[model samples]
Target chain A: MLIVGGGVVGASIAYGLAEEGAKIGILDAEDSDFSASRGNFGMISISNKGFNNLAYFRLSYASSRLWPEFASTLREQTGIDPAFDLKGKVYISVGDREFAAHAEKVAEYARRVGAEYQHDILNRADLRQMLGNVRLGERVTGGSFSPLDGIAEPLKLYSGLLNAIQRHGGSILRDHRVGRIQHQRGIFTVEGPWGSLSAPRLVIAAGLGTPDLASQVGISVKVRPQRGQMMVTERVEQSFPYPVSGLLRQNPEGTIMIGVSTEEVGYDDRTTVSVLRSLAMKAIERLPDLGSVQITRCWAALRPRTEDGYPVYQESHERPGAFVITCHSGITLAALHKRLLPQWILGGRKDALLEPFGLGRLQSASAA
Target chain B: MRPPHDLPEPPHQVSFRFGDEEIEAWEGETVATALLASGVMITGVRAMSGRSRGPYCLIGVCHECLVEIDGLANQRACITTVRQNMKVCRQTRLRPLTGEDETREQ
Candidate 1:
């Protein structure tokens, strides 16, 4: 198996396949590639996902459930803790209107998914109890809390996955920006700046580079670069009990990750003052204590999102052995990509879980 | 004309003004090094949060050593050369002072 892109998604898939005794070779792009895996919000969150698509919600929920075991396995195998914390995730609402909307959304999602979905629409008092010492601003009315949603240190997770892959006899070729991919007679030939390699099966997990590589294999992957700008504060005393999605959350290291503005700026991953200021202001508004924290660094990353903002996991019909997997929620979906995706890729079993995420949905939506 | 190691040691004693307080410094050293040597930490305070920050990564990588030098804002102290009678102050923010603000300061 040959996997293009040695990011978290590709690394996860490669590690899983290698564990299954498949001869795996991963070709990673240069450091210049727009790597969402390195710059994600690192939330294994299922709080505000799958608003329209139930399959996405289910996938995220399942992945969040699997993360603890997956994190432990990686730690046991590679002695690197991914820092997977599933304590809970809180989504704060600033005003009464926002709180009502959040409550409604939580109610609707619970009604739709029923027993599978679990969350609590906390009022101001409940939120105060849950948050403990962490003070919420005066404007914060209420929030929604989900026990399943959590976070992991993404860089550590990626490193552990890579280490596991290498330990399991998988070869990783770094600085290999795959330029051309050719498929003929069930054999896939991938050409990069460094060299070419032939494999019976090929997986394109190249993030923003997915569209181009997928097209070579006749797969119409409608993935575009959606840039998200984020800011990091200097290390402070840890306050928040769990990760908060909407405004800000302190990592275990005491540094808070404040994010994020979604801009369809087309591969322009440069932080702007306006977006960063707004993020800082909003963070301060949510947590008044953060007003005394210094922003150490700010960065922007291009997330590979499909047209409808769902993942695109599709096997090329034109070329049977080629698969393209792309998503914005790479961190949230790492467990799924690691454990289940390899089965679908190697066994050729089109699991129903992956049904809603295929290219057919895009075609149908476009046709309609 | 000589190698850096063979070069004569510059004056060991130098003085600079850190805010209103006059502090002793070493010649031919960066402002950050001089400040650390003088036990003067918290080089600057952030604009947004008003949080105090000190020099991190003494090599000029992290921008944590931002300070005001000779009435100029947003100077990187880690890279800036310290000279005799150089006036240094903790930078409150990244925003540059306007003409009116500069005049008021003067």
Candidate 2:
């Protein structure tokens, strides 16, 4: 088996296949590649996902549930804890209107998914009890808490996967920017700057590079780059016991990770002062005490997003055994890629769970 | 460690203030280098986490050497040269640049 893109998604899949005693080879781009896996907010989040798409919600929930065992397995194999935390997640609302909307959304999601969805609505007092010592801003009225959502150190997780893949006898080629992929007679030949390699099966999990590679294999992967700017504060005392969604959350190492401005800037990963100021203001509005802390570092990363902001996992119809997997939520979906995706890829099983996430759905929707 | 007596003397010495404390600096050295030479590691406190941070990369790439110089916030200490009587204050939080500040820059 051969995989392009050695990010979290590709690394997870490679790790899975290697664990199953298969010869796995992963070709990674140069260090200069704009990797989302390296710059993500590191949340294993499930809340506020799949507003209309239940399939994505289920996939995310399944992955979230599998995280505990996955973290343990990686730790045992590679001796590195991915810092997987599932204590709980709080999504705060600054006003009554937003709070009511958040509540309604949670209710609707729960009704749609039925008993599978789990969350609790909390007032300001309740939120205070959960977030010890961290003072909330006066405008924060309420929030929704979900036990299923959590966070992890994304870099550590990626490193653990790489280490495990190597330990399991998987070959990883670095600085191999895959150019052309040719599939003929059930054999796939991938050419890059490094060299050309052939395999019986090929998986393209390259983040933003998926569309170009998939097009060669007759797969229309409508994945584009959506830039997100993030900022990190200096390491402070551990404040929040659980990860807070949409607001600032302190990492296990005491540094608070504040993010994420969604912009449609094409391929530009430069941080602007205006966007960064807005993020800082919003973060300060949520946590009043943060007004005194200094921002240490700021960066921008491009996320691979499909048309509907959902994942695209599809096997090429024109060329069999060639699969393209792309998603913006690479950190949250790592467990699924590591645990379940290998079965579908190796056994050629038509998984009903994966049916809704195919490229055909996007094509059909476009046609309609 | 190289002894101070064995090392060549600086071409010129400069004086500066870091949060009310007087310090000596080399003429060609940056503010970050001066702080490091004086054993002042914790340069600034983060706005969101309230944690202390020191210069990580000595180079200007990290932006870990952010300090307020003469009331101007968000100045990079690693790139800014130290001058005599330079008032260097560690930035505790991000101060939003106002319209007047932008106009001043213009």
Each candidate's interface RMSD = 12.3, 9.9
- The native-contact fractions of the candidates, in order shown, are 0.00, 0.00
True contacts kept of 1: 0.00
lDDT by residue (tens digit), candidate 1, A1-368: 89998988899889889988899999997888888876788888786788788888998888888898899999999999999988888888999999998899899988888787889888888888887876789999999789878878988998999999999999999898889998788899999778899999999999888888988888876778888899887555566787777556677645789986898889788999999999988887777766666577899988888888898888887888898898888888888888888889999876678788888877632221
**Candidate 2's residue-wise lDDT over A45-156, tens digit each?**
8877787988989889989988999999999999999999887788878899999998998898889988878899999999998887778889999987898888888889
lDDT of 2 at A9: 95
Stretches of candidate 1 off by over 4 Å are A364-368, B1-24, B27-57, B60-106
- Global CA lDDT computed for model 1: 0.82
- Model 2, B24-75: lDDT tens per residue? 8877788888898898998888776688877878777777777888877667
* All candidates: TM-score: 0.82, 0.82
DockQ score of each predicted structure, in the order shown: 0.07, 0.08
Q: At residue B90, what lDDT does model 2 achieve?
A: 88
TM-score of candidate 2 against the unseen true structure: 0.82
**lDDT at residue A81 of model 1 (Cα atoms):** 93
